[model samples]
Target: MIWWAVLGAGLGCYLLKLAGLSVPPAVLAHPVVSRVADLVPVALLAALVTVQVLAAPEGGALALDARVAALAFAVGLLWLRAPFLVVVFGSAAFAALLRLL
Candidate 1:
């Protein structure tokens, strides 16, 4: 039963990709469409980060933990134009320090 669901999801994803490919180049080239395409990944990544930070590991309840503080630290670094490695490592260290306390 799980395998059937997995296969169905795989097929659905393939169909969705095919549908995206079927869109006309003209539509894809429109200013609004192009801007949306560029921003979609950013929006998706923000949503992913939000879910990871706020969602509890074992249940549906929202969590407030060291991860939130670490995320804020990372955002501050980004606002300061810190390099990518600094942002990643700084956030990890901040989170580790918070957890260790």
Candidate 2:
């Protein structure tokens, strides 16, 4: 049952992406739409990260903890133009250290 639901959801997402790709080039070539398309990934990542950082699993309430400290390290590293691997590892290490303390 769960597998069926997962398969269906995956299929639905793929079809939606396929539909988006099927859009006419003329419509896609519009300047405003092109700008928006460029920003879509940024917006999606921000939304995904916001949810991950703020949302609680059990109650769906917003809570701050070691994750916030880890996120701070990530942001500072990003601002400093650190490499992606460094940012990721630095944040993970900071978060683990926070948890240990």
For TM-score, the strongest prediction is 1
- Highest lDDT against the true fold, candidate: 1
Consecutive 10-residue window with the lowest summed lDDT within model 2:
54-63
C-alpha lDDT of residue 48 in model 2? 95
Residue 83, candidate 1: C-alpha displacement in angstroms? 1.0
Q: What is the C-alpha lDDT of each candidate?
A: 0.98, 0.94
- The digit string of per-residue lDDT tens for model 1 on 3-61 reads 99999999999999999999999999899999999999999999999999999989789
Poorest 10 consecutive residues of model 1 by lDDT?
A: 52-61
User: Taking the tens digit of each residue's C-alpha lDDT, what string does model 2 give over 1-101?
Assistant: 99999999999999999999999999999999999999999999989987888888686679798888899989999999999999999999999999999
